[model samples]
Target: MDPVLDDHMHLDPVNGRGVEACEEFADHGGTHLLVLNKPSWHYGVEVEEGGDFQTAYDHTVDVVRESNEVLAGRAWPVLGVHPALISQLVDRGYAPEEARDLMRAGLDTAAEYVADGRALALKSGRPHYEVDEAVWEASNEVMRHAFALGADLGCAVQLHTEDGEDFTEVAEWAEAAGIRREHVVKHYSTGGVVGPTPSVLADREELVRAAERGIPFMMETDFIDDPDRPGAVLGPKTVPRRTRWLREEGYDGALERAHVETPRMVYGIDTRATLE
Candidate 1:
């Protein structure tokens, strides 16, 4: 098998390191780097000239734009509305209604970029710090909009569920919201609903149910090599080992078949090698 695609990676070069990492990834024969955009710390703040904020939702769009401009088709933009930052949307200075509207507009703009062949996928699934019913509801609303746009644009939607229960709830809500399971992909299944440990054996059964229901599941490490990041909970070395383990446990062929052949058929991702 070819070097697996790094399905999700966050390499913002606000300080120049991100660009270097992108070059290194491309040099390593990585076909695509899905750059998941998160709001920059400088979002909502005034910046000097040439320091424009271009993040998809807030500061993230700028990063995507720069990366795409620099990488020239080697990078794919993945717009993510991190769960922990939901409150930031309605914080003191920001208007709740206006922020939500801006978010929708941002997603629409991102979707348009993807539709125009400028990006790859529209993804969601960053970790949440303090989730509640309201947060889930808000996130569901965002997901509904993203799925609708993605379906029309022929792009894929990535979901990050905390655990078994959260996954179940998200699935049910997504179905009720009219999001097709075929267009939604789950990321990082090994992370338990509540923590970074391997999912319970029973949760594996639940995953099978999800798979049988048509939801395309894809695994990813949130960050590439940052131990301080949440994806590090499983440890960097552990990620590939888990991938190998899962493959040995009877899902390798299934994963390859689903994400490779079927995903290409459904999402139009090219499986053939093309000289750039």
Candidate 2:
């Protein structure tokens, strides 16, 4: 079987299924995961400054560590400030400019983790919903900073943004920051419309369309792992199960691209090696 990798997912040991979720994935034949940190608020950390995000980042590292201990590097961490944090900070009484600065600082801290080799990628993006022009610009600025950091570290940066974004502006930012366009990935993306690279949602139709269109893409579950919303985006087994479906349906070429080729190209990790 091709090595099945879910490119984006979260594990909440505190309020969610945690490492058990990873076991479920493994049991279902998932060979690897790009485990991202949940929001700071999810960890109950009130971020007044950049350093405040350290606690949340640390927790994320710990969770990823535990996951690796269980599955021997089955999970890799992607740390960064969640983009909606702009609104959250605003609601918490921070000015728009202040929130942007704090988010940049947070990404700086995440970059520190990447620098230390605790994480394999960085995450950042603008709000998916509507927001004020100032807020939008601030979010874009923060994401640009992430791109710059990824460029410096030679790591991939996963973006969480509103649907239907072509990422042309984002591509320009990545270029200016000196990161490859392929490294700027749209997490939870549905199709080739996202950008040069997309960590596409693991919907069969979308996956088939992405393959048929010949877009460079990866697959993700976006599995929240929150018990309250059980199987909200998708279950932990989705990617592996989908991989099996693809094989059974004889999409041999698409299977290789989604599971092995794209992951090695984007994140620079050999999924097949992880299983060895």
Candidate 3:
């Protein structure tokens, strides 16, 4: 069996099933996972409470660290403020400047975690491409902070963004921020275009096309870990399950490259992959 890795998933203290989810993944033949924090819409994380972002940011850091502990060296953490959180704050009457300030603080804290060896990458980027000017600019500034931090710390960033015309535009953004092109990733990529970070959730046909493209990429489910939705984004076993299927169909080379080598090179996450 080829050791498989999930490059992205959310399992915060809000849902309270993150650890169990990781355990289930390992039990199902997964080798590694990257745990992400849910900044909003999980538990009582509304920004209207207490001293605001710092408290939540600290809590998220703890959440990621604890997730690593639960996985017992099988997983690492990707920390940041999701762009949706900032955009919603703006819609909730917070000024764009205020929203950007909070996001910068969150990115700074994530970078500190990387420094401490507690986390691997910063999960930061705009939610989509069609946002209003003010919201878009604020998210861009916040992500700029994340990019600069990733560059300084030699870490990678997983971007959650909407559809766009050209993926190279993203690479240009990373260059302008002084971050390496390999350090930037487009999360939940559909494999519709050629880019560096196309860990696609597309169908078998699209994935085979991506396989033909042969540009190094990773695979993910973006499993939201929401009990209410119950595998809303994707089932937990999706990647490894596909990995096993690939093995059966003689796509082991593709699995090893995308599931192991690409993630290790791009995000610095190395799993215990053994040749079968």
Off by over 4 Å in 3: 48-73, 273-276
TM-score of 2: 0.96
Q: For every model in order, what is the number of clashing pairs?
A: 10, 0, 0
lDDT of 2 by residue, 1-276 (tens): 458888998988888988888888888888788898898998788898888888777777877877776663377889999999999999989889999999999999999999989999999999999999999999999999999899999998999999884778788789889998888889988866555488889899988888887767888999997888998699999988888887888888888888788888888988888875
lDDT of 3 at 47: 63
Kindly list the per-residue Cα lDDT of model 3 for residues 1-276, writing each as its tens digit: 455788887765555576667766766777677777677545465665323444544555666566555443466677777888876777888898898887787688777778898777888888674677888888888887888888899888888877652578767778887887766878787655554467677356656766767667777888887778887688777877877776787776777778777887888665653222
Q: Candidate 3 — worst ten consecutive residues by lDDT sum?
A: 49-58
The C-alpha TM-scores of every prediction are 0.65, 0.96, 0.88
When 2 and 3 are scored with TM-score, the better candidate is: 2
Candidate 2 deviant stretches above 4 angstroms? none
Top-TM-score structure, candidate number = 2
- Each candidate: RMSD to true structure? 6.4, 1.3, 3.0
Q: Which candidate should be chosen as best, given lDDT against the real structure?
A: 2
Q: What are the lDDT figures for the candidates, one per model? A: 0.50, 0.86, 0.72
Residue pair clashes in candidate 3: none
Better-scoring candidate (lDDT), 1 or 3: 3
